[model samples]
Target chain A: MGFLGYRRPDGSVGIRNYVAVMSSVSCANGVVNALSREMTEIKPIIHTEGCGRGLADIAISTRTLAGLGKNPNVAAILIVGLGCEFIKAPGLADQIKPSQKPVEFLVIQENGGTVKTTRKAIEICGKFLDYADSIKRTDCGWDKLTLGLECGGSDALSGVTANPVIGVAADWLAAQGGTVILAETTEMIGTENILARRAADPAMGEKIKSLIRKQEKLTKDILGPLAGLVISPGNIEGGLSTIQEKALGCIIKAGNSRINELVEYSAAPSKKGLVIMDSPGSDIFQLTGMAASGAQLTLFSTGRGTPAGFPIMPVLKISSNTELFRKMEDDLDLDAGQVLAGKSIEAVGKELVSLMEEVVNGKQTKAEINRQDLLAIHTVGPAF
Target chain B: MQEQINAVLIHPSDNVAVAIREIQPGEAILGLKQKISARQNIPRNHKVALVEISIGAKIIKYGETIGIAIQGIEPGDWVHTHNLKAEEI
Candidate 1:
């Protein structure tokens, strides 16, 4: 199967053609937002990770910023900077220049001020948009696509229905020579053993376990002694008792496919069929990491219901609860709750794959159609 | 022979079954002995008591104890935040 998508200079296929205004540092977000606002064709890609970060943290932020420019969806990029941040705008622009896409830089300080920077950035973005618009869409094979699998706001049905259904779609995509990324490291807590069993090699299996351990350690260190307390409230309300139970259910979204590789958060996959990405369970952050890693689209499973979207990638929301689907029809795209009503999982899985095809062929998801809330926050150490 | 309603028991240790649908009051649920009541409008993904239990009894779902009963609950009663309280591990 093939869909009409923009062909990037790097030979990557982009389902959407957007001229992106990216902020090099948190301080320059306002300027980038203003610049995007002035240009009808320019879309602002904002995040909360560029400043006040240590070396490792700044590295992640810089890599993620550069990855956003590398995303196929972004035809051309304009980097806005405050001029003296850890993540330098010039460095980011240089990193993206190899993509053969237009990469421009504007420093708020060098440009004189916010108003002047915004004006200059807007003019640069206008030209970028014109260049972006000049690129025409061409039909591309399904193999050229990479999909991100995600789940949030989960409940019991999430495991039994939506996740597994989405899993089926993941396997289908992988079978078609397409790439699939399974993220949310925190959710794999108790079920890492099961996932590890599907690793392509023993080293990859150990890596899976290592990532889970690192995530648990980080959560404990960050949240302190009462770290586990947060799980109680959501689990109690949703009828989940233990972290193990949630993990088991959460792992179902990975399906039964062999995990081909393990990637760091926001790191692009070298070669992909099915890969595991280390990411937090936070919905927006995980989605952002997935997008930065070059996922063309994302499939999100929700049991209780969540309405999160991404600026560059289309997020397809699926719910396992029919009631939630009905109640949040405007936010959800598919209902796999029928698995609970005795519908076969295979049938629902097939349906999910078909729906994915429809989504790839220019169908707008509920999140994209409504222009729902989209935000990203990367976890990093203090800026030094 | 009739086919049993397909439902995941989660764990062998749990006594309650999660309602996959809006099981009305007095309706006999497949695969279990108890008939359920609307209780409090048990929406999809919500839990239902499989056996009558007094206050403080642990509520099990997904084969793990999710919360404890805050009040006496009858079989078929909906188990949610209102009637169940989360306990520290």
Candidate 2:
């Protein structure tokens, strides 16, 4: 069955026809945020990057911002930049122009300051919103959909319940020809060989192995045997002493599918099947990376409960245990804890897919309803 | 009365099982041969060696080697950071 979606000029399918305003640099965040306040209809994406950084960070920020602007969920985008910044607003607008969407830019310095930029950006967004509203939604196939696989705040039940359920749903989407992205390099430390074996070709397998091995070496220096970001007193108490055991829980959400293509952080995948985006294990960074890569929606599972949602797309939260689901009833969307109560993963997965279909059909998830709009870009280097 | 399970063996080839709930010292691990009893207090969600493992042997869980035994481990002994060391690929 197809869901209603907006067909963009560049032939991309968008589940949400949102007009977005983003800051090209941290200095212009005030103007971008002002634009959002002036026109609440426009989604504002504010980040702390874009200026005074090394070449690697500049490239990463530029690529990530451009990617976010080109995402199919965004009908049009307005970039606000401090003129002196390394990553320019015009550059970001130019990069996103190929998407055939209405892309605009306002330099805070050139536009007389934050006040003028905010006023001008508001007017631009007003027109974009009107144009976005005029667009019509048509039935789009699942093949046009790309789903990001994410899990955080995990408990022991996460691997056995919610993750496995998410895995089944991921497999279902893959079978329907939809794209699924499995990120979180830090979580795949021990499973490098296993993931490598699942790759579609020898070269892809080697790439997968190398990517995970690199993460293992990088994170191993920080906390000894523990993978970065996942080492907590809770994790230690839960019997996850090694990176492999911890990562094994996270990779299950990718489901049992042949690895198709592996892309750099925030880069779009060229293949159709299950792809992997090289992203950090941190929730917000990874979520933004997936959004920048054009995932209209993401499936997130949590044991302790994380309420974060992307500004441009929907994030569906699944709770591992029934207690947490009940506690976070207003925040979480589904409960996979029924597996502990004798319900099968297949059944929960089918329910999750149904919810996904409803979401794609315009139904809002808990994250969307709560407006948990959070965004953070992953960086390779620190800002100067 | 129904038998209650205390630990979970995630894979057939795994020599370690995770304690689903805390098992006291000398308590028999459920779902296994009655001969094996907990050698020490196995905390909830912690690993318990299901078989004898010599030092430097790879510790298996979920059918993959997660770490190596830094010290000799016996059946029902709690295996954690103290006894296991994570290896780099």
The most accurate candidate by lDDT is 2
Deviating ranges (above 4 Å) for candidate 2: A222-243, B1-89
Ten contiguous residues with the weakest lDDT in model 1 chain A: A228-237
Supply the global lDDT for candidate 2.
0.87
Q: A136-185, model 1: which lDDT tens digit per residue? A: 98889888899998988876678768877887788788888889998888
True-structure RMSD, every candidate: 6.6, 4.4
Query: Per-residue lDDT for A1-384 in model 2, tens only?
Result: 878999999989999989999899999988877777778888889999998889988888888999999999999999898999889989889999999999999988888997887878878888898899899999889999999989989778888678878988899999999999999988786788878888999999999999987877788776676435555777787778876777777887988899999999999998988999999979999999999998999999999998889999999999998999999899999998766555556778899999999898789999998999999988877667
The CAPRI quality class of candidate 2 comes to acceptable
When candidate 1 is compared with the true two-chain complex, its DockQ is 0.16
Clashing pairs in 1: A52-A383, A53-A382, A53-A383, A54-A382, A241-B66, B25-B37
TM-score of 1: 0.80
lDDT of 1 by residue, B47-85 (tens): 667778789888765344556788999877777767777
Q: What is the DockQ of each candidate?
A: 0.16, 0.31
